[model samples]
Target: MGTALEDSEIYQKFARITDSLLSPEIEDFKDSGGKVVGFFCSTVPEELFTAAGMLPFRMRGTGSTSTELADTCFTPINCTFPRHCFNQALEYEFEFLDALIVINSCDHIRRIYDNWIDQLDEPEMIHVMSLPRKTGDRQVDWYREEIAELKGKLEEHFGIEITDDAISDAIKLHNDVRRLQRELYELRKVDRPPITGAEVLRVMVAGTALPKADYREMLQELIGTVRGLEGNGDHKARVLVTGSQLDDPEFIELIEGQGALVVTDATCFGTRLMWRRIDEDEPDPIRAMAQYYVHDRPSCPRMHGDQPRRLDFLKELVEEFKVDGVIGERMNFCDIWQVEHFMTGGDLKEEGISFTQVDREYILAGKGQLQTRVQAFVETMKGTD
Candidate 1:
């Protein structure tokens, strides 16, 4: 198979496994070693966790079906993605996560850290890190202190001290992946790009679970190869996706494959990460972190402290991206997206922008239905009336 075909086949296999067989396999893997499980959000580095010779898994949300575990602590307005995923951790789905490294990037997630410690009595399973504040160096020391503290926790958990070399290696792995992802993103920025939205998402999710260096190389090669193709595919409707934890890029794939250009994003799994950069020469790493956490476009309900600015941010993307429509994807049980969907779209619609809303499941069970809806929406937007 060609690289694209091979990669597609691999994803098809994993999706089937995710659908038909992988739960038990992942369960088995979880059981094989009582290894360390870490969660790094936005700015906090995940490199250290990987360097410790521990199986580091990024925290993902659970499925759409509701659970009482999350309700005990979080309000009804919290984003359902994290609630569902974290609830799974609290319930039966997370037998493998020895500990959760929670980054206090936004309000609700930070609050969740405390709930995990107190209500769940999960002192052993929770490591909280307060992200640095963007406008100042005052918080850098505090962030470094938190990093140091997390290192101590990992040491105690694994019964081994983390070495400086391990930290450097882990940072290199994650940083390399970031570099490649940036290149992959550039393909779409070009007039005619080869890779699909689904392909992009597949590579990104794999980055979380696979070895970063290899992942980066494969992505860089994929983009480099794809950019050369003079894609003659039809793409009349132009759209941008805005949502929470929409890492799969399936929305973009589904809509664009039919006849739409998914040109930009406001999704955490995409632009939110894509826009932020780590300043190598900053007095402390926390400075870069603080900027990412506080300054990235805010969409989650919990991050609404300074949210008046996000509306303008969305407008900037719409204008710059030349978007003809917007697709607001909400996690099925996500309280935050549910709210933001209405709020953001309301602002755009009033200005005569075309848009649609999709409530998605983690596994993308109802994608065919979503595809049909988007196609119809695109037709309407095109004035094919």
Candidate 2:
């Protein structure tokens, strides 16, 4: 039954986009004189770019085969995610972007801004935001100022104005995207989900690649299509995945291939991107966006003093989705997520939730080992049941 949904035309369209760095929609958008601003972290607001009449692209290393070229610039011990992304840039995979935006989410990601400025010739405009490590009123205010600064840069560089009304409209448009995504996630709460985790990831990653309006329409059609199909109940265990910046559906597919249904996740590219909405009625849309993005959404490890809140959020998802186990997968050398995964494994175990931790490369390299670990974990869950 899940296969029926995965085989649909719309689902295939999403998969095609997720499978590559450049998509046809992006090419068409470029052809139509639309500018694209590529960003690294989820903390960077996409609405600001939309308000500026430019597409906000979430950068990823989807088709990267190796970090060979990037290794010359980055150390061997750096997190592979950013290394692969920089490799993609070096290979000219991201030449379509008119500008690039980065945030100080972590040391590994923050380095991209320095290296990009020194190395890249394309993406004429490169900017980075200094995000606060703690959440507070002052921090939110600071972030709002940062957003305003970026907005001003866009307006000045592109010879356009990101008016308050345009920002408000962009907020409303993105809120619709969030609402539709929440609707799709609601379907995953069932005993048997019509859509697989890999398929859902494909859809989510597609959102980062396509224009918000086009992605919203495709999501609407997809949610309607999925609702009509029967659910797939063939998996042995219900699992929730959490950890480092995951953008590849193949990693999720590897876990699901081991007879576990990845019902939900707390990863950057997954629920974290769509879980919260910006207040549409706030007279100051930038402040509203700052409040929502900085304080309201789920906190990743980069945000200090939020570990308890993150664990609580994961536990809530476990209860709601009836998750049998949690898999904490992090990229090697990601100090923040490494600490988070350690604490999460111990904390979730204290609550009697089964937890397994995996260390993976930026690209999917150790397939046999990952498959073995996942298979053993699923078997253990089955036995406990």
TM-score of each: 0.72, 0.98
lDDT of 1 by residue, 313-346 (tens): 7787788667788989876666656777787788
Root mean square deviation (Cα) for candidate 1 = 5.1
For residues 123-201, what per-residue lDDT tens digits would candidate 2 score against the true structure?
Answer: 8889898888888889999999999999989888889988999999999999899889989988999998999998899
- Which candidate number would show the highest lDDT if scored against the true structure? 2
Q: CA lDDT of 229 in candidate 1?
A: 58
Clashing pairs in 2: none
Q: Residue 300 deviation, candidate 2, in Å?
A: 0.9
Off by over 4 Å in 1: 1-36, 40-44, 51-55, 61-93, 103-124, 130-145, 159-173, 228-232, 248-258, 296-301, 308-321, 332-335, 346-353, 361-373
Score each candidate by Cα lDDT. 0.62, 0.91
On a 0 to 100 scale, what is the lDDT of residue 329 in model 2? 86
